[model samples]
Target: MAQLLRQLERICGDDHVVTHPHALRTYESDGLLQYHVTPRIAVLPGTADEVREVVVACHGAGVPWVARGAGSGLSGGALPVEEGVLIVLTRLHRLLEVDLANQRVVVEPGVTNVAVSHAVAPTHFFPPDPSSQIVCSIGGNVAENSGGAHCFKYGFTTNYVTGLEVVLPDGGVVELGGKAVDLPGYDLVGAFVGSEGTLGVATKIVLRVIPRPEAVRTLVAFFDHTSEAGQTVSDIVGAGLVPGALEMMGRLSIEAAEGAVHAGYPPDAGAALIVELDGSGAECDARFDEVVSLCEQGGATGVRIAADDAERELIWKARKAAFAAIGRISPPARGARADRRALA
Candidate 1:
């Protein structure tokens, strides 16, 4: 431990390398909280060069290192391996470039998922919005191949990732894809996006963006039973109308959310389906009408469409906060095995 610290201190100065137990505790777990392991050392690297140096030092000492983003992941992808170094990349957060004409945004791995959309919101969007977009990092999104409500239409993180600069396990740097598509050989970039941490660490990435839709309408359908809401989702899909997002929440989730954020929903409603349609004004209106009719057929007692921006935000907020709203559903446990347990 002392040797690793000394080596990191030499490479990035002592202040940047954290060996103190108290400070290292934060990196022990991610959002899941089920698994936790304190790393022997945690280093925050500000640049790709600094990260490569740290990886080289770990290689020289014959030690392993785990790359971490915002640690908002639920899969323990950022959980520190026993006796390994945890390389936190939050310090490397930066929006390297935004090419509006080409619809591409280059960002460091540590940049937040929401930051990408926030950067393009005034014009269009980056669209792969996980519930944790406000806190999760794009690098982690790439690693997890994350999907969210909008993914039913916009697709997953792998769909948006266009280029990546990675540092391989053997400590060699390579650029898999570039600003232009089909840069030559194999589509290595596609393979690495969801390879998690086993493949390598992504230092930088290029994301594809799209123009904002002309109109978007949110329809909230309240059903008397959970299955009714689920069937409504099926009916909506069956009608040949692909909404931007089709999310269903059960009684437990709806109750918890009502308690937390009261999005003007029926506290007694058995279930809720938040369907969103985005596209041309005519298409949105046409599809919106079909969705309402389908929900009614599926036994939805009441249906409401957001009439304005404020109403639309309220509808999405409750859905986005589903994780936190349902926290009371599980008890918090510390220092649990961060990995999956299999039965023999």
Candidate 2:
């Protein structure tokens, strides 16, 4: 162990290697705090080559290792192994390139999900925005196929990822896809994205970006019953109106969120639905009216539509805050886990 530690230190510098008992504890668990295992060592490589060297050293020494991004994943995918190396990728942060002509963006694994959209803002944006986008790293997003709000229209993390530079388990480096679309050979890129880090470690990534919509509208519809909210969602979708986001929240989460962020959710509401629609101004205006009418038909007791971007952002803030808000009210139950099988 000492020999491998020294080798790792030599590869990534003494400052980058974390072996202190207290510091190692920092990598013990990811967002899933219920599970914890203090790693023997942790390393933060500063570049693609450094990452490969660290992985190579671990492979040669027969030590298992885990790759971690921002450690915001709740699925325990970034959980540190008891006796393994925890390779933190945040040091690799870089927006390598942006090509609007090609609609492609190149980034290192450590770039946050929201950063992609910000870098291409006003003209284009990355669409797979998980609730944790602001902090979640693109590498982890690829591993988990994270999806939020616009996922209903733009799809998951896998959809935006066009290419990856991977360091295999045995220290071999390979390119899965490219800036150009529809590459020949096996769809290794597809198999690797959501593998939760089993296939390999992504070093560099190529992402697809889309042009921003001309107009957008957001609304929060309140219903006396969850069934009514559910029916309202059905009505909108059935009417061929594709909402950018159609998130439903029940009384419990709604109350928790209101208590935390005060996002203007009605107190007496049994259920709330956050619906976002985007397109040309005329199209959004035409469809927004129909969506509002359908909410009424579905038995909505009240509805709040975002009057401006500020209001729309607040409405989304409430929805995204629901998970953490609940935690403030009640600590996570022992042996508890998120039911990933549940639909959004």
Stretches off by above 4 angstroms in model 2 are: 179-181, 332-344
Clashing pairs in 1: 35-338
Measured by lDDT, the strongest candidate is 2
In terms of lDDT, model 2 sits at 0.91
Model 1, 157-210: lDDT tens digits are 999898899988767899878745466677888899888777888999999999
TM-score for candidate 1, residues paired by index: 0.94
What's the count of clashing pairs in each model shown? 1, 0
Q: 224-324 in candidate 2: lDDT tens per residue?
A: 99999998888898999999889999999999999999998997799999898998999999889899999988998888999999999999999999888
Backbone-clash count (model 1): 1
What is the alpha-carbon RMSD of candidate 2 to the true structure? 5.1
